[model samples]
Target: MTLHRLILREIRHRKVNFALSVLGAAVAVAAVLSTVGALRAYDRETEAVIDEMEEATKAEMAKLEDEIRKSMKGLGFNLFIFPEGQDLSEVYAEGFASRTMPEEYVTKLAESGVVTVNHLLPSLTKKLEWPEQKRTVILIGVRGEVPIAHRSPKAPLIDPVEPGHLVMGYELHRSLGLKKGDTVTFMEREFTIDDTYEARGSKDDITLWMNLGECQEMLDMKGEINAIQALECNCATVDRLGEIRAELGEILPNTQIIETQSTALARAEARNQAAATSRAQIEAKEEQRARLRAEREKLAGWLLPVATLVSMIWIGLLAFINVRERLPEIGILRAIGVKGRTILGAFLGRAVLAGVVGGVIGVVVAKVVKLPSVDSGPIIESGEWIAAIVTAPLLAALAAWLPSLAAAQRDPAEVLRHD
Candidate 1:
């Protein structure tokens, strides 16, 4: 007989058995699809959290650094006070004091085109005499680079202060109940509020700003500054700062130079530690997700086999009935000289066909139950879709094959004698 004729005859004779096996395979395929879907969802959730935290952390650090720079400048501006011989409460317009170098010293330094030997003044602690508290708030002196804000146009009260105007820390403003354009007395000198701005660090919160000259005069410390900060100029500027330090030491040397590199290094190390911790947390999270995924895969390994095993038992029972019912026909065919192996082949073929049909149906069922697309980031990366499709059908085929083989080997002559 032709292969088509054989196939038709085989399926027609065993239609019931074929139908049952198809049902079993279809169910097996559906189970496999569900397992793969769960894993993908977890993958996406972990990645999204990591990205947001990284961005926020960096922004916070930058904000802190910027705030520190502003506090320094504000302190520097406040240090603008009067000369040593000059009296306090005389100089006003918030400015710096220059040290009195001899005329020839200035001339020679100017000739070097490097050392500009002008009179550099020192600033002292500003004192805020609070009458109610009966205690003076000793204002900490900051270096140059303070952030100042002004009043808003509509409000003229809450605007961001511009440079050259003094701004107070937010808390300091609150404590004194001071607003924009209010004057606060410190070091016996009356400095205008000019404007009020929010605080960035500890110093700005408690300190008042004025010209360094005014600060020197008010504090009664003149022609000297606490520290000389360097601008990143050539080697000459660096060298000059060092030389000027010695000259100033001879003149009135009691100040110290703070090495910014150490501070910067410490800051960078802190940032590195933070980043490392973040990375560690992320790794731990990812590892946890990986562990969960591994568990899921293990569960799938058990479930696929278990589902196929249970499904195959049903198929085996169906195969047994089909074999029993057709035994008389099978015995007659054998007596009429048909081959035994051929009978076995025919039965096996029918089961295989049924299993394939069941697998296809199961796959169709899975396709019908589409997972709703989640908009969560990174949840559905590439390659996962490929895994889902390939695993489903193979599992279904296995479910049907093992049971049908057992049924195919039954003795037809013995079965024919059954009632």
Candidate 2:
């Protein structure tokens, strides 16, 4: 028989092995595709979260700057005096009042007539906005100390009129639905929201405000205030917190210096750094996981095609072995004049027929059940498709080559001796 006929005969006879190898190649291709798909999905989600954080950061920084501007009015000094005609000597002696700043400074202000202290109640506009939240809007108290008067009504954009009146920010006023001269409640007490003045670039414009005396009574914080934002002579003057703490200790010994900026900023920066580090670590772990997952998927992919290749090779092996076993038959043919190349050709033909049938079956099966391409990564490249298809066959041919070559190497004389 012709060498081609001999190869075709063996392939047609061993249909089962031919079928298995074709299936194996299809599985490997699918696994490769699935891994590429998963990476694409992960990239999109992380991008959105970063954008939200950026906006929030800018808003918070603006709040800090406003607090600094407000605090600058105090110039690190203020003098508190008794009410008009109240006789400071008696008030000082009777223990009803005590000076928090330097006693000398109060004397200087009183002598110069530049510093004056007065007590009055007034309502403040809301500084924060929350829809349907009129009740949540609150009036924060301000002091009528030197810092308060030194406050640039023109610069901050707050309109502080006579006793019992304060300004509101446009943003705050619009939210609370209150108008100038309107009334609002504080601790169930009432005051007029008068003379709304614009505080440039501050959300505090919404705050309807009154003097410290009103805040102390309304908030029920008599002799106790939540915070003090005294103006420093210079932003440079309050460089070190320890110095501020020491100077504040000497000036306002009993009052606590609560921080809205320096201390808070230090802690915030530390936390931001830590969060960045954690995100990087998480990203590292994710990258490692992606690699591992890809490997497992590739392995899973090989199972079917590899099994198919092994089965087909085994089928081809059995046929070749049987032919080797029929040495007397093979020897007679050789003796009659069949060439060694023809004998080798016969075994190779079996592998080719099986490979083609299996490849075609694999290709058809892969096509029918073809999974849609999954999006993977921020950028999926075009090379992946070409690589997967091209590699599958090369692997299959290699798998088929070894066993077929082994079948061809047997000595014809030895095979005939067995007969």
TM-score of each: 0.56, 0.40
* Per-residue accuracy of model 1 over 1-419 as CA lDDT, tens digit each: 75346757867766666676677766765565544544455455546655666676677656654554343333442122223453223222222223321222222222343332222222344446645435545443333321111211121112333323455666667877989888765434455677565766645565555555445554555543433332221122345445544443343322222223333334445556666776787678778767876877798789977886777776666666666667676766666666766666656666666666765676656545644432332232234434434443344334434443443454556656662
Q: Give the TM-score of candidate 1.
A: 0.56
Candidate 2 Cα misplacement greater than 4 A, ranges? 1-14, 24-264, 270-274, 277-336, 356-419
Clashes (candidate 2) = 28
Please report how far candidate 1 places residue 335 from its true position, in Å: 4.4
Tens digits of per-residue lDDT, candidate 2, 90-159, equal 4335322222222233223323322212111122222233333444444555554332334333243223
The superposed Cα distance between candidate 1 and the true structure at residue 306, in angstroms, equals 2.4
Candidate models: Cα lDDT each: 0.50, 0.46
Candidate with best TM-score: 1
